[model samples]
Target: MNRLPRPERFILVDDNEADNVFHEIMIRRAGFTGDVLIFDNGLDALAFMRQDELRVPTCIFLDINMPMLDGFEVAIQAAPLLEGRETTVLVMLTSSGSPQDRERAAQIPVISGYVTKPLAAALVRDMMSA
Candidate 1:
């Protein structure tokens, strides 16, 4: 079976510094040799996403709770940009395991997945292999 292409860019939009560091390390441990962009808030991440030179096959890991804009808000605004882009995967990598949060994420067509904190290398590998 042919494996799916690994994402060329990994974008992490979370306010927690420690979580960002952990997630980045996890991505590297997964043997993903790609650009990893870390943003402390949703606005910056959205700005980078809006750039014309943004690479394809990008995976965005967004947190649910934030100061300025939350993950849901970002996903809603990003839906237009992500439309028809099969290579782009926007996932909610939040600590919240609430059913309400998951349901909200599911309502957003742009959001590909909703995962809890501490992103694992195995999951990353599976994402790449899928």
Candidate 2:
């Protein structure tokens, strides 16, 4: 199977501090030696993404329920920023398994995947290999 190159950066946007920490650990355990950025809210993550010097081949794990802007809102706003950036992966790493949520995510062109919460090392490895 053809595998995409390893991402140069990982961004975690979620309100839960514990989840962010655990996800960061999992990413490291998955053998990711690149930068890991954690944001407690979506607005901050968007701000970082809008920076002029943002890097490519970045993976963003976004949560569905967040204050100031939900996952869908962030994804919508991020679409333009991610335009033509093929290596950039935006996955909804949410706890909600609602069919509505999944369908909503599916409608977003920029969102590449939807994963349940408590990101695991194996899952991270799979994401990297994809």
How many residue pairs collide in each prediction?
Answer: 0, 0
Model 1 bad stretches (over 4 Å): 1-4, 53-55
Query: Which lDDT tens digits does candidate 2 get at residues 3-110?
Result: 245788899999999999999999999999988989999989999888835556788899999998999999999999986776678899999999999999999988
lDDT of 1 by residue, 1-130 (tens): 1123578888899999999999999999998998889999999988887884444677889999999999999999988888777778889999999999999999898888998998999988888776
Error of 1 at 117 (Å): 0.7
Tell me model 2's lDDT, rounded to 2 decimals: 0.87
Off by over 4 Å in 2: 1-4
In candidate 1, the residue pairs with backbone N, CA or C atoms under 3 Å apart (3 or more residues apart, or in different chains) clash, namely: none
Query: Which candidate has the highest TM-score of all?
Result: 1
**C-alpha lDDT of residue 34 in model 1:** 83
